[model samples]
Target: MKPRGTFRNTALALGLAFLYLPILSMMVFSFNNSRLVTVWDGPNSPTLKWYAKLFENSQILDAALLSVKIAAMTATGAVVLGTLAGLVLVRFGPFRGRAMLSAMTTAPLVMPEVITGLSLLLLFVALEQLTGWPEGRGVLTITIAHITFAMAYVTVVVQSRLAGFDDSLEEAALDLGAKPAKVFFAITLPLIAPALVSGWLLAFTLSWDDVVISQFVAGPSATTLPMVVFSKARLGVSPDINALATIMVLVVATGVVLSSVWMRRQERKRRLEEQMARSDAG
Candidate 1:
């Protein structure tokens, strides 16, 4: 049993090491002063020059900013659309074409990204030819494509939450002369806020990291960070790539830390409020 336990621990360590070693290496290499990525001169090799160079790279910064803008827009649109779809599915009960709606909403989760990208490309081309609405493909096209896929994941998140939601809260609001919209706004929306937030974050992450869909829908005018990174990677990994990745790692880590702290504070505040209410009741 001890030997088995040791073996399990060793396996877990190896698994984690394998997953993180590349990231660790990237972080270390990002600080290297030398332009060549593979060279390890000595202990004093680490420097902040790459980070400085990264900031000076206007094209990479432009691409990163474009990606962020697209992600933000896509996440917001996905949340709104997803919430409406989820509310319809969960609250409205069995309706005509309910099965079809549900199927379509979940299909993106399983569909290959390449296939989805191709279909969206065809769709945008058709729309452009037929109406000339978009005229050309760029940020708007990329955003719409992202929203199309991200909305599916967001819908699933919200729909699952709504499915498990207690009907009593909304019913009570309605029983006390609240209209459907009022009840949704005052009661249901607040209750499902966490799901909405999760959905938005999920959508944003998907949009931010997407390569294939963006590649298909993106015009020459709107190059995304991932595309820039992929293009650079083809010529062999550069120190700038390492620096950019290290910065992203820092940003993600900071976000996680801040979010965890905020959640803990919120939890504490709720508990304190509960205690005060209990004291007043007594």
Candidate 2:
């Protein structure tokens, strides 16, 4: 038993090390003095020259801005549509073809990204020929494609939240003569706000990190940060790319930590309120 436990602990430590080693290396090399990403300078010889260069690159800056805009729009669109779909799935029962509809809604989540990208490309081409709308491919087209994929993830996250939610509160609201719409806006929406926020963040992160779909859907004028990074990496890794990647890592880590803290506080407050209500009723 002791040997088995030691082996398990060793395996877990090795797994964690393997997972984090690349990220650790990237962070370390972001301050490397060499322009080449692979070559390491002596300890204490680190430099921030690459970071400065990244800031000065206008093309990279523009692509970063474009990525942010697309992520924001995709997150908004995804949350709105996904929330509606989730409500329907949870509230409406025994509808014909409901299973099929649910499967289709989440199919993109498991589908190969290349297949999704190709399918969307074909869709855009057909839409252009039939309706002549969207006239030319650009940010709008990329955003639409991103929203389509992001909504699937958002839907799954929100649907899980809705499934675990109790309907007693809604019934109580209706029994008090509150209209369905009013109750939904005042009660349901507030109750599910955290799930909605989580779904939005998930969608935004998915869109921001996507490269395969974006590569196929984005037009000349809609180049994104990932695209720029990919193009640069083709010529071999540069310290500037490392700096950009490090920045992204820090930003994402910060957001995740803050969100976790906020959610924990909200959960604690809810529990305290519930306890107080029970005490009063007793």
Candidate 3:
């Protein structure tokens, strides 16, 4: 029999392969000389035709651009709103209605997208009937919906980071004559910078990839990239879709790699600074 460690490693490898093999296949077939996304004729048949054609597809270009804009707005909104929510929860102790506020802030994390989408749709209808505002569902409604859901994730990330923080550092800054806002900017915000980055990236990805919620909120002409891809996938995969998917995979992978590298560098620099401070004290 295999050793326990060997068995665990084997299982982990198998799990990774299972998850990534389809993505690998998509990447490979993106270069296929054949029109079918699944068929691979060999290295000799690999061509960049699909990739070249990807730019000429106006629908895809429009959807991708709209998705990027929504993701950027959603990420920024989530960061600002979530940071404030996190600060309130951490710093303002035992306020009235705190429990309710916290619960509502986190409800989106566990709520089904279908329920959220339906509820938002009803809300828009009611608002339009009463005030004649938001004439129709489009980018504005989609952005608001994305912010509501994505903010929950950002709040949780920021809250967890704040929970583990050292409060004495903030207190020391205050005792040394720094203002409350100054202390937060100089010490607290810098300390939680990594969490901020992680949360922003998460919110962006969630908004970008959302289908169920976006589908309900989106106007006929305001379709997102994910919606476009999902609709196309129902008709069976094509070389164009494969090329588009490969491009997405590459972008996501690049972001992940760069963020990981940045985090590691920051961590190493922090440790070195700590060591130097200790040596100076000695």
Candidate 4:
């Protein structure tokens, strides 16, 4: 038992190290005074110069801003469409083309990114020739392509949430004077708010992290952060790049910590209410 426990602990430690060691190294290297990202110069080599330079780089800053805008739009659009699709699939009950709708919504999840990117590229080109609507491939095209794939993930999250949801509250609302639309807006939406938040975050992350699809659809002026990072990476890892990654890591870590704390507080409040209700019943 002791050996088994030791082995398990060792395995867990190794797994965690495997996952986080690279990130830890990158964060450390971000402060290195040496231009060589891998080499730490001396004992007093830690510096914030790279971070300062990172802010001064207009190209990276512009790309970061553009990526944020695209991600925000993608998350919003994906959540709206995906939530509706999920509601139709779960709540509307077997309508015509139900299977087809489900299939289409999930197809992107299984499709390769390259294939999806290529197909969307072809689509935009054809649309350009036919209608000349989207005159050039830029922000609009990138956002649409992101929404198309990201919505699949959002739909799955929402569908799962709705599937396990107890419909008693919704039914009670309907039995009362509440209309369907009102019940949906007041009850259903609030109940599934966590799932919606999760879906939006997932979509935002997908859009922000995307490079292949963006590459396929982006115009000369619409390079994203990931694209810029990838382009620079092919040459060599730079200190500014490491600083940029460190900043992103900090942002993500802060969000995760805050969300975890909020969820824990909500759970504790819920449990306290449940115990109070039980005491009242007794």
Candidate 5:
């Protein structure tokens, strides 16, 4: 049992190392003074020059800003639509075309990115030709395309959360004379808040990290961060890129840490409140 436990621990450590070593190396190299990203310039190698240079690069900055805008819009739109779709699937019982709706909501999950991109490109072109509504592919097109695919993921997340939900609370609320909308806005929404948050974050990440779909839908003027990064990387991986990535890593790490701390505090507070209420009752 001791030997097996040691082996398990060793395997876990090795797995973590395999997953994180590349990221660790990238973070370390981001601080290196050498322009050649792979080579280290000895003990005095660390410098902030690349990080400074990253700020001066207007193209990267613009692309990053554009990506953020698209991601925000995509997440918001996907959450709204996906929530509705999930509620329809779960709350609206045995509706007509239920199977079709479920299939459509999840189609993007199984669909190839290339195919999805191509299909959307064609869709935008056709819409432009017929109605001239979108005019030409740009930020709007990119966000729409992103939401199209991202909503599928959000729907799945929300639907799964709702699936295991007890409808007794909702029924009780109704019995107590609460309107359906009121019940949904109060009890239902609060209970599913975590799933909604998760889905939104997932959708935001999908849009922010997307390259293929953005490539198809984005106009010449609306270059995204991923597109710029891919283009630059084709030439060569630069120190500035490493610096930019390191800053992103730091930002994401900070957010995760802060969120975890906040959630922990909230949980503790809730438990304390519950304990106090129980004591008062007793």
Candidate 6:
């Protein structure tokens, strides 16, 4: 038992180290003065010049802004549509082709991103010929493509949360003469808000990190940050690229930590309220 326990602990430590070492290396290299990524110099040689340079690059800044806008729109659209789909699938009971619909909702999560990009490109082309909308591929087309994939992730997250939710609260709300719409708006939405938020963040991150799909769907004028990064990588990574990557990593990590902390606090408050209600009822 002692040997097994030691082995388990060692394995866990190794796993964590493996996961974090790459991130740590990237962070360290971001501060390196040398352009060559392979060579690491001491702290005396490390500099923040790349970070400063990144701020001065107007093209990179523009791409970053466009990525943020696209990500925000995609996340919003995904959360709304995904939440609706989750609610319908979970609450609407059995229906014809229910399994088929559920499968379709989850399909994109497992599908290759390249395939999704190709399909969307084809879809846009077809729509152009049939309806004459979206005159040519651009940000709007890229956003639609992102939302299509992002919705799958959102749906999966929301559905997991809804699965654990007790329907009795909803039923009780109805019994107390509350309208269905009111119950949904006040109780249902509030209970699942954390899940929705998580889903939105996940979708946002996915859209922000996407390169292949955006490349396929984006117009010449609309370049996302990932696309810029990819194009830059062809010429070998500049220190500015490293600095930009580091900033992205920091921002994403900060958002995730803050969100987790906030959700935990909300959960704790909810549990305390439930406890007080039980005590009063008793």
- Error (Å) of candidate 2 at residue 143 is 0.9
lDDT of 2: 0.90
Can you write out model 6's per-residue Cα lDDT over 1-282, one digit (the tens) per residue? Answer: 356988999999999999988888888888988878778767556799889999999999999999999999999999999998888889889999889989999899889989999999999999999999888998999999999999999998999899999999999999999999999998999999989988998999999999999988888989999999999999887878888988988987897798789889999999999999999956
- Evaluation by TM-score, superior candidate among 1 and 5: 5
How does residue 127 of candidate 4 score in lDDT? 92
lDDT of 3 by residue, 85-160 (tens): 9989988999999999899999999999999999998898899899987888999899999999999999999999
lDDT of each: 0.93, 0.90, 0.92, 0.96, 0.94, 0.91
What candidate 6 gets wrong by more than 4 Å, as runs, is: 4-13, 41-44, 263-282
What's model 1's overall lDDT? 0.93
lDDT of 1 by residue, 1-282 (tens): 356988999999999999999899989988887778889756667788788889999999999999999999999999999999899989898999999999998889899999999999999999899999786999999999999999999999999999999999999999999999999999999999999999999999999999999999898999999999998999998898899999999999899899999999999999999999999956
lDDT over C-alpha atoms for residue 142 of model 3 = 94
Q: Write candidate 4's Cα lDDT for 114-202 as tens digits.
A: 99999999999999999997989999999999999999999999999999999999999999989999999999999999999999999
**Candidate 1 segments whose C-alpha is farther than 4 A from its true place:** 1-9, 268-282
Candidate 2 similarity to native, TM-score: 0.92
TM for candidate 5 is 0.93
Alpha-carbon deviation at 9 in model 1, angstroms: 4.4
Ranking by lDDT: 4, 5, 1, 3, 6, 2
* TM-score (all chains, Cα) for each model: 0.92, 0.92, 0.91, 0.96, 0.93, 0.89
In candidate 4, stretches whose alpha carbon ends up further than 4 angstroms from where it belongs are 1-5
Cα lDDT tens digits, model 2, 1-282, are: 356988999999999999989998999999999766788887655888889999999999999999999999999999999998888888899699889879988999999999999999888888999999777788998999999999999899889988988999899999999999999998899999989998998999888888999988888888999999999899898888888999999998998899799889999999999999999957
Weakest lDDT window of 10 consecutive positions for candidate 4: 37-46
**Which portions of model 3 show Cα errors greater than 4 Å?**
1-9
* Candidate 5 wrongly placed segments (more than 4 Å): 2-9, 272-282
- The weakest ten consecutive residues by lDDT in model 6 span 37-46
